[model samples]
Target: MRWERGRRSRNLEDRRAQGAGRRTGRLRLPLPAGRGGKLSLTSLLIMVGLYFLIGPEALQGLGGLGGGGLPGGAQVGLPGGGSGDVASGPLRTTPAEDELVEFVSFVLDDAQQTWARLLPGYREAKLVLYRDTTRSACGVGQAQMGPFYCPGDEKVYVDLSFYGELRSRFGAPGDFAQAYVLAHELGHHVQHLTGTEARVRRAQRSSPGDANELSVAMELQADCLAGVWGHAAAQRGILERGDVEEGLRAAGAIGDDRIQGMAGRAVQPESFTHGSSAQRQQWLGRGLDSGDPAACDSL
Candidate 1:
């Protein structure tokens, strides 16, 4: 949470002023047939989140919301230009939004630095700050999808407005909570670099019935990876009192069971793609307690 004195990342791509240049139609998610010949309520919401809340390529077995290859090391367009091109124009942003940008830049740099020390041959991933919608190698990224990391392009896309929703709607307000979001996405990038994501994708492909379970495991591991960064940050005196709690709250707030309950549906563990609130908190806490990436391998 002590980010004002931190170094800003050079890998940041700011395209807030460029605009999406196209209207995003209402997204309709297809509920594939599940157990018992019909998808459960939990399965339905998982499909909704798959198509709109996470990265477009988060689950490649599903239909293409956008075109891309495998989840790990997928060849795609480079940063700066493409469907999400940045046009030359004045950037309009309020003081609060500008501060948020600075904060994220600091987190991105700090987290990558930690990984560079912890993992061999670690590569830095770019973070794209956009408004409304932006083009990623996986697909068209909209604000509604929250924050996601596209392994195809090795870039993390974020819409700052989501922070407001994280606070007001999800009740997970704090700078560290925002940092956790970016850290988790970057964790996915780490998985991509290490071939963990590729292996998981292959497993999902081989076992179509267990795809959701595999997704839950992958997501929980990412949460733990985020906590690993949090542990490093704390040791460096970057975190203050209550920062860890903010992150845990954020993790719990977006848990599959909690989100299902919020939607007035019964909590179902079988359809969970991101684990339950307890599972998320437990994995994140494990990393925080151990400060070791190996501790996260239990997933």
Candidate 2:
């Protein structure tokens, strides 16, 4: 994406180096101490059975990993070692990081501007970049949970290292991919501002069995919003020839099915909080093709 000359948002918050505090210490997991300590076939079968029964959450606990004892930690699936061991801190980003930040800020400005012009009483949302954990209106925010928007605070939180995963592991490399991620989170902010997020969350509680489906709709709508931003960027001459493809790739890379597959499992549609790869691509394409926010009603 041609983003350098674009407008940067003032809502970008850099808290990369603020570790909250140093980790207690190196966490040493227990391993069986014996000759030929390979797990028994019976044990393996039982573990597999548990995996099939309880899902990825069981797998993480069985492995004795996770930062904050949750899945998708630095040890489990993160690109960089999640420690943010920068001499100057993760907030003291490099020129390349700065470029990415600037690009995201510009896209955020574009998306918020679009919303402001299109939606009544639209308020700009703050996007925060932090390392490890940070306090938010939605309790402690972890980088492992990836980027998220807190509806209560009307803020978006991200850890830039995730952009590395978006590139290396997810195979969605490019500046535009990063922008798409930012725009998606901000799209959640849009949902919050429009009261869509709260209504969905409330409905999720009442309809517990279909909670995941509601979340999928919410996520897909965000993808559509991101696509809308992509279209706007194109009209503004900020998008390059392959930029839309980059965003589409990103939308696919983070699909619930692809993520579940990477974590070693079958694609369980009912369990998906985010939509499937095809659904995400479809929504993104819908917005890209139409460039209309009104067309993003996945509900």
Q: What lDDT score goes with residue 26 in model 2?
A: 24
**lDDT tens digits, residue span 159-220, model 1:** 77667767866789999999998998888898899999889888988988988888888888
Model 2 regions lying over 4 Å from their true place:
5-8, 20-72, 75-91
What stretches of model 1 exceed 4 Å from their correct place?
5-7, 20-89
Model 2, 139-248: lDDT tens digits are: 65655667777777788887666777678777899878888888888778778888888888789779888877787888888888878878887888888888888988
TM-score of each: 0.78, 0.78
Question: Which one wins on lDDT?
Answer: 1
Worst 10 residues of 2 by lDDT: 59-68
Task: Please give me the total number of clashing residue pairs in predicted model 2.
Answer: 0
